[model samples]
Target: MTTTASVQVYTTNYCPYCTRAKQLLTKRGIAFEEIDVSNDDEKRAWLVKTTGQRTVPQIFIQGSPIGGSDELHQLDRSGELAKRLAAA
Candidate 1:
């Protein structure tokens, strides 16, 4: 149950939530792929279409959407994030 799920985060450069999310993931020793959509209209549009969310800090864990910073923090606090991260 230690499968390293690939984490992908869509964020902007100046988003505080994005910063916090990255920090939390780093603290947990998780490596993630960060896509900065600050000026990329196409990617942002794709995110909106794909997630129905037009905000920075959109995250996907092992191809599963895990939402933004608040949700991620909540999951971490509830120990769900750890469980998800450890899932095979």
Candidate 2:
């Protein structure tokens, strides 16, 4: 990761938004830990329980939920994602 923020993204292999999210983060030079929960029921369950969202590509920055693909795009568009990613 370029920044000190610990970014974790929960994703499924077949999710297009997951790919987009990764691409956006990579384009911003942000590195993240991607958890592939495609076949892992336990991890998926855990993600849902923690995030309250049963969708793929649940993203976290420094353990703070930043929401999914559209939210990420919105953050990037509003220049907040860069600020957050650049944060410690």
Query: Candidate 2: where is the Cα deviation over 4 Å?
Result: none
lDDT of every model, 2 decimals: 0.90, 0.89
Model 1, range 6-54, lDDT digits (tens) per residue? 9999999999999999999988888889999999999999998988999
lDDT of 2 by residue, 1-88 (tens): 3666788989988999999999998887788899999999999888888989999899999998888999999998998987887774
What TM-score does each of the candidates earn? 0.92, 0.91
For residue 19, give model 2's deviation from the true position in Å.
0.3
Best by TM-score: 1
